[model samples]
Target: MLTKRLFSSSSASPNLFKIGSILKQTRTFTDADVLGYSELTHDANPLHFDAECAKDAGFNDRLVPGMLVASLFPRIIAAHFPGAIYVSQTLHFKLPVYIGEEIIAEVQATSIRRMKNKYIAKLSTKCIKCNGPLVIDGEATAMLPSLVIEPPNLASASS
Candidate 1:
């Protein structure tokens, strides 16, 4: 389990999330996306870059990298849970995600625990092809920053 501090601040309250709280995002991976990801990450897998190779491997089209698909989870988490630390994640790649296929990434909070000044949440994560099949299944743990609100100064108000 790898832990990463995703952000630092007190912009969001840990109370924003609760058991069964859910978030969903939809995306369609394109040729440009595949090329750019390959260029940046040097993943250059034949299944991702070569259609013939992918076909030979039993897929209809060039496959998207599993990491690329899994990356959506972090994006969803960070956007909805600002200032939350992405403590750890576990992923299982279940099926090939082809280029140009629309997929939906979803995260649901399953549990929340308070530890002193922060809240730790356990989340269920998954991605599914649009009207098709499940592509990824996973879990994530995050540390949400606690918001601090100071009481108004009574002496100043009295003056």
Candidate 2:
């Protein structure tokens, strides 16, 4: 079951994040996506690169590599919290994904605490298909700087 949460807030200066903050992104896996990942990782596993081989091996179809699916997790984190440094992540592969399947990655900020000079956020993360089957589930810990830094003006630097 996919339950979408609604948030309404009007704050002039928003904090970097808050507990319960959520981010979700969905992407449809493509043949190009699988091939590109395989080329990048040098993982030519028959299941990922060769559809005929995959079918022969008994999978319903060519399966998307687990890491390829899990990679979407970081996009959600970065979208919500840029410059947040990932300290650790634990991922569990729950289901096989096939080409052209849309998968959604959702992450929620579970805990935010000050650890020394930096703030650490613990996130509850999960990826699911459009039909609600779990593909990946795990937790991630990220360190957010206590102070946000504004980027320097490139024009000034170039002059």
Candidate 3:
């Protein structure tokens, strides 16, 4: 017989490498939030803001596009992960995120590898809410200026 329990599958971990991640938490994904980002990033993708366009495209409503969720890296890096530069990111969408739906996005370090002067952080990401489990799972690699070489939080200094 098989028993069912939460977190029985993949083990979720935290990101740790250059030392500045102080910490963070889950957050909601909002239409207004995404729309504002679209304007700032100058990426006026209809899927993020145009509800009608999204509906026509087969979404229940204005779905938060993939790229938008991927953008969470920036917010994560800025908010709590204070010393990393996103070098590569890959996310597999399991479902669509409708406008106004709250999403829990997380990036936990799975492992770390050394590369030149910087380091690579292998992370596991997920976006989950009332709809059930995560709608997406992602892996990301970031190149960071190590405090081991410079100072603490130096990654955010350039911004």
Candidate 4:
């Protein structure tokens, strides 16, 4: 639960890949995104929608839905290492996320179950500028592809 260090990606790589560490994807929050998420999820909590209410609530502005922001982790992990099998994910919403705020999600390979052929990635998603702790802290399991290969196209098979 620390903000510093933690970089190992896999046990397989002596150069960079090792168990118990990972990297991150950075993103900025926008007002439209907050509003849209509120609209879609019906999470009209004043802290997330009403500017005045949010001001009163002690937030600089309306906050973002934790769930909507959290949904990006999978995409980030996938983007970092394409074709890796994602097996598990668990998120704990820590603090509120504000619109116009940028966040960086850090993912680490905590351990691996060799017999099961699966890897565990412990993740910390947060906004560095705000001085607040991670907005979301979680763990994910993914099966990293040992080699790249194309899967048969299901469209052609069905035809």
Best by lDDT: 1
Q: Per-residue alpha-carbon lDDT of model 4 for 16-129, expressed as tens digits?
A: 335544455567778888778878877778787688998997778887777777766666556554677777678887777777777766665565443233333444433243
Off by over 4 Å in 3: 1-24, 42-45, 49-52, 114-118, 144-159
Q: What is the lDDT of candidate 4?
A: 0.59
TM-score of 1: 0.80
Residue pairs whose backbone atoms clash in candidate 4 = 10-17, 10-18, 11-18, 20-109, 21-108, 21-109, 22-108
Across 1-159, the per-residue lDDT of candidate 2 in tens digits comes to: 332232323441243356666667788889998889988999989888777888888777899888888777666565455577888889998888899888888777787777666677787889899999998999998776642322322111000
Instruction: Name the regions of candidate 4 deviating beyond 4 angstroms.
Output: 1-17, 83-85, 115-132, 147-159
| Residue-pair clash count for candidate 4 | 7
- The lDDT of each candidate is 0.75, 0.71, 0.59, 0.59
Model 3: lowest-lDDT 10 consecutive positions: 3-12
- The global Cα lDDT (0 to 1) of model 1 is 0.75
Candidate 4 accuracy as TM-score: 0.64
Tell me the spans in candidate 1 whose CA falls farther than 4 Å from its real position.
1-15, 146-159
- lDDT at residue 49 of model 3 (Cα atoms): 70
lDDT of 2: 0.71
Give RMSD to native, each candidate.
Answer: 10.7, 9.1, 10.0, 9.4
Give the higher-lDDT candidate: 2 or 3: 2
lDDT of 2 at 124: 89
Model 2: residues >4 Å from true position, as ranges? 1-16, 146-159
